[model samples]
Each structure stands twice: as C-alpha cells, then as structure tokens.
Target: MTTIVPPKERECERCGRTDTWNDDTGTWAVVERDGDRLSGDPFCLHEWDINGAYNPLEEGA
Candidate 1:
C-alpha cells in the first residue's frame, strides 16, 4: 500500500516547477511540456507526493 503522507514539494532545477515524489521510478520529477523521465539526478528521498503528473523525459530537452 502506498503511504499517503504530506510530501514535501520542490521546484525543479530545469523547469522550476513544483514536483512531488514519484513511486513508480522512485524519484522526484516535475511535469514539463516535453514528457516524463528520470532526470538521472538525485532528488528522490522517499518524502514525495504522487499528485504530480508522470511523463517520460525526452532524449534531449
């Protein structure tokens, strides 16, 4: 069961939008006009919310 805790929100470095925690990929990624994908950066710390939209990050964006 996914724990519903008050996730800490953060702004993405690239997009500068608020993003919560992602459980599928286990990371924090914000929604962008492009798509959804792991930034390959360290952002996920388990203190995240799944309310944000999910998309795969494009090859180059």
Candidate 2:
C-alpha cells in the first residue's frame, strides 16, 4: 500500500507569515494575519527552509 500526503500550510520561521494550500487554484494563498491580509513583510526574505528535514515528494516514488 502507498499513500501520499502533502503539507497543507507553511509558516516563515523568521517573520511568522503563513500560507494555506488552495487545492482549487493549485497555489499557496497568503493567510490573513491579525485581520489584515499580506503577502509578506519587509524583513522576511521569504526563502523556504527546505532542507534534509523537509521532503516535498515521497521518498521512493
């Protein structure tokens, strides 16, 4: 048996900005922060921390 699960949301460890996966649009949409919607902040570089700890795809698929 095989199963695939993708991350639903990801947050910047630096600025705390968050985004939610939108299956309908096939994109990550910015989630509102404190009632205000924003794409990002001036301080955050927006670089994804994808390293050995994270895998976007299945291991052997």
* Top-TM-score structure, candidate number: 2
Scored against the true structure, residue 5 in model 1 reaches a CA lDDT of 61
Q: How do the predictions measure up, each by TM-score?
A: 0.29, 0.59
Segments in model 2 whose C-alpha atoms lie over 4 Å from true places: 47-61
**What C-alpha lDDT values do all the predictions have?**
0.47, 0.65
Over 1-61, each residue of candidate 2 has an lDDT whose tens digit, in order, gives: 8865667777766676777778887777788878887666757776544342554442332
What TM-score does candidate 2 reach?
Answer: 0.59
List the lowest-lDDT window of 10 residues for candidate 2: 52-61
Output the number of the lDDT-best candidate.
2
List model 1 lDDT by residue over 18-58, tens digit each.
Answer: 56557777665564446754343454332222344433342
| Model 1 ranges off by over 4 Å | 1-8, 11-16, 33-61
> How well does candidate 2 match the true structure, expressed as C-alpha RMSD?
6.2
